[model samples]
Target: MLNRTSLLAAPALAAALLFSAPAAQAQISTPAASPKSTVTQRVGLTDITITYSRPSLKGRQAFGTLVPFGKRWRTGANQTTSIKFSDDVTVEGKKIPAGEYGIYTIPNKTEWLVVFNKSTKQGADVDGFKDDQDVARVSVKPYKLGNKVETFTIGFSDITPATANVDMMWELTGAKFKVTSEVEPKVMAQIDEKVIKNASPSANDLAAAAVYYYDNDKDLKQALAWMQKANATDPKFWNVHTEAKIRLKMKDYKGTVASAEQSKKLALDAKNADYVKMNEDLIVEAKKTGKL
Candidate 1:
């Protein structure tokens, strides 16, 4: 019963609608309420990373009204707040194995419970959170801040070679937990495996072992022996300077002056003015202290 023109128009109209539907869907955009952030740091031989979302205060009542007390929070706005540790760590005296974990907090007026959950796949609401999957639960005291924080922030404070504090700040309250990584065991392992056991260790390898020992207040006698081996292999100005420093640590001021002078000669030939000046300063100090 349809005419020729009407028949063709029906198929054309269907085609147009099909193409326009995708275009309409593509025009939609989703804006996140909070932005994502990441923080990474190294504590001794361990690497730590934290990924989270930042939500603004927006002048709302924070503690009791918005974020209810005694209830577990996702510790961020959007996805689950995640923390990754490269090695096993002790959290508030509790040992936790190395892995990625979801961070959650139960806020209180005096103290808060920071939980590291083994299950990392969860939403901001934490609908699927399991208490049995908790790797660690640390109790940390909350401190009232003098200045108001506009947005939620997680950062590392009081950083050292072997330790750092992970701080969470929002509104006028802050909570922190200490993270420590052991350096001595790792350093000794590297020294044993790479320097001592290696059949053909390079000059750089010996020098690295010596520097580690010197920096860590270890046996200066062993460090000096390593430095001597490094010097015999390559005789670099830096290694010679390191030998002078080891001698000074050992209170052998005469040896320090001699090694420093040799370092100065090599540095001068290599056009390194910094090492020349450093060795000259060391020589002067040795003479003043040793009466040489």
Candidate 2:
């Protein structure tokens, strides 16, 4: 009986030891906050979203230490990073229509070439990249980073009501691309004239016209007038809240505060997340200016 008991106890102790090793390692490595980051931006008429796992310097040499220079980086990790365009736009002087594509970058200290390939499934390496799948390739100048960034990050900078800059940083290398949010006024004018002439304008037509007037033309009075018409026509239309953003851009802090507050209440009643966020952002801006 003693021998049998000893044999059973020995096996149980070995199993516990085996399980504890992995658990201990996991606990030691896990961080208080996850290291992953994501950036989403709308390009022209297309929506571009990028998800990447951030790497840190952490006492190691960056540039060549972490991400080697002159190598093709997936630009992110895990999944092949992707950029989706809502409409066709010009990148690096080459016109690319609205579509989804994989983003790969060749990193260098002085400059980096941003490649937009039609192949969204291609891996980080150039080995799988197809020459025929190439869309547009642009060379972007790299800038010196003032601070040591531990993790990879991408976001919009120099943001305005109409435009923003998409900033990419990894290791010691970084690049920026200008993004324009407004469609051409000629296009908007055509749409407005056609819609009004042929039939009564719908909510979407008014929304598009308002955006064009506000963003492209910088005509706040016209934009506000159109938006007011849109709200009266369809109070339930979710986009009327966006008018607050235009009001903010026009530097009408008082008008922006009022529009944003009203939009927030309307969005809450309608249960629209996009409008809710827009109103929330506007309210934050209003409070910053002591207008809220």
Q: Name the candidate that leads on lDDT.
A: 1
Mind sharing the TM-score for model 2? 0.56
Alpha-carbon shift of residue 109 in model 1 (angstroms) = 2.7
lDDT for 133 (candidate 1): 88
Q: How many pairs of residues collide in each model?
A: 0, 6
User: Per-residue alpha-carbon lDDT of model 1 for 1-292, expressed as tens digits?
Assistant: 9999999999999999999998888856686678899999998889999999898889786777677899888887877899999998766677878889999898999889999998777543546678888888999999998899988899998988788899999899999999888778888898899889998778898999999899889989999999999999799998999999999889899999999999999999999999999999999988888898
Q: Give me the overall lDDT of model 1.
A: 0.89
- Residue 271 shift from truth in candidate 1, angstroms: 5.8
Pairs with backbone N, CA or C atoms under 3 Å apart (clashes), candidate 2: 45-86, 45-87, 46-85, 46-86, 46-87, 47-86
Give candidate 2's error at residue 211 in angstroms.
7.6
Report how far off residue 291 is in candidate 1 (Å).
2.8
In order, candidate lDDTs are: 0.89, 0.71
Model 2, span 40-139: residue lDDT tens: 7754444656666666656677666555789877776555667766666666556777778877888787888788888877776657777688888888
Quote model 1's TM-score. 0.86
What TM-score, over all chains together, does every model reach?
A: 0.86, 0.56
> In the order shown, what is each candidate's alpha-carbon RMSD?
2.8, 10.0
